[model samples]
Target: MISYIESFKKVSESRLNDHLIFWAKTERKGKSKTEIKEQGLNIYNVSDVESLIDTALERGELLVLDITEADRTFSLSDDGKLSLAIFLTDNFCDAYKAYSIEVDAFTEETKQLPLSKMTIMKYFYRGHSINMLKENLALANSSNTISIAYHHHLISNFYGITSLEKDACTFHFAPRLYVPPEWIGRKVTIEIEGLDEPVKLVVTSPYPNKRYYVAGVKLGRLNTANGFYPVIKPRDSFPAHKELLLRWKLDDEIRIDHHLKLNFKFTNSQGRFFSSEQQLLPDVAGMKKFTLTTTIDHSTLSERNARVIVHDIFNHYEIHEDATLVNFPMELHHSVKATSYFSKWYKSWTAEKELI
Candidate 1:
């Protein structure tokens, strides 16, 4: 029951959707699976829920987690009551566990109502019981701390583009790719519409511990103009609109680190404009969810397409002399969207099969 679905099953059994476990409530009797699942809610563990709340606080994001106690109050030990009161008083200042209890008990009450009129409650021990409850609840509600359900399918997509200078631009790749150790010294080429030739670059692992890769052309090597290089410069004509900002919602299981920088390159396409790099800042690398960021001038452009080269950024002094293309920050890929798509497709296909 430590796993997410198993825990939910333990909590809600076959009668409820996974997300309902979060609300500490359940659908009334006779609600079908279709009716319940359509609510499209997310299930979060106490840690993730707490980390998310902290991240939201850091970004000053507006999140409303409404926990309304029942009309009737239940008895607790004097110490337990005081601890719970103190936790509730400070606006749940990192009290995701308390909220978890509230929801879990509420859901239990719904199921038990048929059997008895008694109110159900979670028992917290006396004294430091609040801390113990938090620890035990976190353990009881644990899920894979870093496992993404559909990571291999790459549901995250190319979300946006940003311009760092006349010659350099950054591509926002989703759900950072795991760079292989073998790819550290590999060479790759990127082709752009306006460029006379493909941009040649090498990949290097700057942070080996993090397993992050960077691919970029070293400007120092450009001193001797070899015929093989593309002319990296601004286009002759600039579009009226030069800026863009794009955002997307992150899936529940996707976590990212905040220190990421957008992998950037130099190009001269008239359609492209100068943009700023939006770092997907998750607290611990691949441990916390991050907000996607992109910026352009006030004007926006249509989605541009390019062949993803070793799709993955760096500074001049910071760039490894042997590195080819610069490595950049990454977003969670299209796994969520792809998962949703396949689920719907599979359900429809199954229905057709049943009819046949």
Candidate 2:
């Protein structure tokens, strides 16, 4: 019994190694053997390999095995090998199940509980892990219905897309198409809607029809003259209102009849803002100065707002107005400068600052 058990363990380990090698071969097609080695799971040793087989059999976890007396080989029964495969598969399935449960629990918890962004991130991470486990398990069980289900589940959960297509045998994320890299021997995916909740697609073969690369480039950036600007001040100050100018520029493509508006609030030192938060001020509003000129048409652009804010130092409070809208004929380069007018009453009231 001891020898049988030992032999079974050895066989189980060998079988696992074989399966792992097969998996590695299919997974690392374009990758080098050295790269696989760097992934922390390369080849197995003779003795340790046997130990895995033994352990599985001892635990009655070996599902399938084959034993043939004619060949004078004492191997595991087919059931034993299958049992082991199922056992390994269970780890991933179990993780996915747990993830689903956690998601349900999170929904329930959040219904009555106030959760922070970090808490939501944790839930997302758990879902991501579940997706990864499902992906790996699908790779291990390729060509099997179980693998297909796993792939489908992962695609639906992470990428918000699912595939039941006839052409593709395997399930895939619909939003993303897998493309083979030109220079590198690995597969790359082009994301359509930026990286947020991006679609993930796997490329199994190197075919011209299976790959695509993104072309054309357009760039834009936001700029301001001074990072700090007072939106409100005392009534006695030099200027009764502050001016804030914003500019925009476009490259490559020309935009027609572009309308621009910014949403912003005046935050105090403690990050608090009062009601009536938005208003259209003259300096940034109106349709007169929003148009783009031909000189800075394609490569550069600029826009300016006059007296955008009023500072009431006597009241010790600032009134935040609505973002002004700028309508232009074409898109161009742009910049902004904000000036503040302070009142004497506002300055005197805030001068004697006291901690609350």
Candidate 3:
């Protein structure tokens, strides 16, 4: 029996060696320094010619027929040609090595779904890895593919009932997708047989970055038993000490009368919580957007957490909470774009930076 690990190794070696053979088979006959540089910078996504050549040489003597020092050219040996031929044949006959991940999801109450699996059969040439697999897959199918899959996986692991008081559960992943601000407050449904109907969820916030993305999801309780609901949608970051605008919405079922009070609880990194209260008096509640201007005294820090609560809703409290990091000093403007000088240098030398 062929060992999968050994087979993978064989495949990787063959793939790398084929790069060298490609130069030999070209019309120019052998690989020149310029050709080698191009292959290193473009094909392999590396700039160090010495390291690239060293890696090719590690495949063994058979891959290189001759290295002409005078002209700085390379040609594949007979054995290398044979290896390249086998590699080509294998690629045609067998599937290329693919990467996949077994993702698990759950509701804030408990884990409800079995592990969901996704695979990437097509290997991405740059930054070849499992992260690349997911990134490329998302790109190919459109980001919506990942958004749906992420929700499905999260819903599958949910168990039992949950109250609005529960905090939004977060799932961290390397989605490599730019989640727009408009995606916030979007509703998603998950169907399970035992439930009365599909369970609805809303995208409260999504903190996406090159390393990982934090997805904030919570049960979309459009209709509450007490008729008191609040969903706070705050920006990921804002300016420090300045008047920050905190936006939240009241569900249609909520009655914004004199008896109801909306509470905003802000907590800084020091674990201190500040409170703000407002008695809403809307004409009638059919989903209303409210903005409250507030400032955190924590000038030393830039991140905080928030929770919104509806109090005295006929003696019941309905709440929506999220612990996603809300950064301050809006001047920093942290985002997913690769803007560092090193990133630019790397892109100019090789390919684009793999933000996974």
TM-score of each: 0.20, 0.18, 0.17
Best by TM-score: 1
What stretches of model 2 exceed 4 Å from their correct place? 1-15, 21-43, 63-65, 69-98, 102-356
Candidate 3 regions with alpha-carbon error over 4 angstroms: 1-35, 38-157, 161-200, 209-356
Going through the candidates in the order shown, the clash numbers are: 38, 66, 7
Give the number of the best model, judged by lDDT: 2
Residue-level error in angstroms, candidate 2, position 34: 18
Ranking by TM-score: 1, 2, 3
Error of 2 at 284 (Å): 57
1-356: candidate 2 lDDT, tens digit per residue: 22233233334334455665565456666767788768534434544445655675576645333344321123444555445334433534665456546644643453322222222233344455645534533443342332233334433433345653332221111111122133223332222222223222222222244332111111112111111112222222213222322211122121112222333232212111111111111111122222211121111221122112213432111112223322211111122212111122224334644332
119-202: candidate 3 lDDT, tens digit per residue? 112232223464554454335435333323322333343433232112232211111112223333433221112212333333
Name the 10 consecutive residues with the lowest summed lDDT in model 1. 314-323
In order, the Cα lDDT scores of the candidates are 0.27, 0.30, 0.28
Position 88, candidate 3: lDDT: 36
